[model samples]
Target: MSRSEWQKSTFSGASNECVEVRVVDGTVELRESDAGDIVVRTTPPKFAKFLQGIKAGEFDHLTT
Candidate 1:
């Protein structure tokens, strides 16, 4: 899928600086707000694990 087709996260703050993501062929694609139509893809499992760790506070430094 094209980055232009990706939807912005509803949880995004007022600032338009957010990433858009989509699952394609068992992979997750990510792109920054100002990245235009370029996307980076990662394995679904890896993305899930990363998300789990983030929810578990393993990536708390990101918020700090």
Candidate 2:
């Protein structure tokens, strides 16, 4: 099946350390630009929940 174009947040701006995301065959896929061979896959609902948690600051501690 064809996959959607990979996308990364504009905030990443020239940074290869950022994560890129795309969807294929009803699954959401995420990968680190610096490590293109590795990928993480999850369902759309689960990915949405993860995004919600990130927006809610659940991962703030990990960034610091």
Score every model by TM-score. Answer: 0.69, 0.93
Roughly what TM-score does model 1 have, to 2 decimal places?
0.69
Give each model's clash number. Answer: 0, 0
**Candidate 2 per-residue lDDT over residues 1-64, each given as its tens digit:** 9799989999999999999999999999999999989999999999999999999999999977
lDDT of 1 by residue, 1-64 (tens): 4333567878896656898877776678888888758888899889889889978999888886
Whole-model lDDT per candidate: 0.79, 0.97
The candidate that wins on lDDT is: 2
Pairs clashing in candidate 2? none
After superposition on all C-alphas, the RMSD of every candidate to the true structure, in Å, is: 3.0, 0.8
Question: Candidate 1 local accuracy as lDDT?
Answer: 0.79
TM-score of candidate 2 versus the correct structure, residues matched by position: 0.93
Off by over 4 Å in 2: none
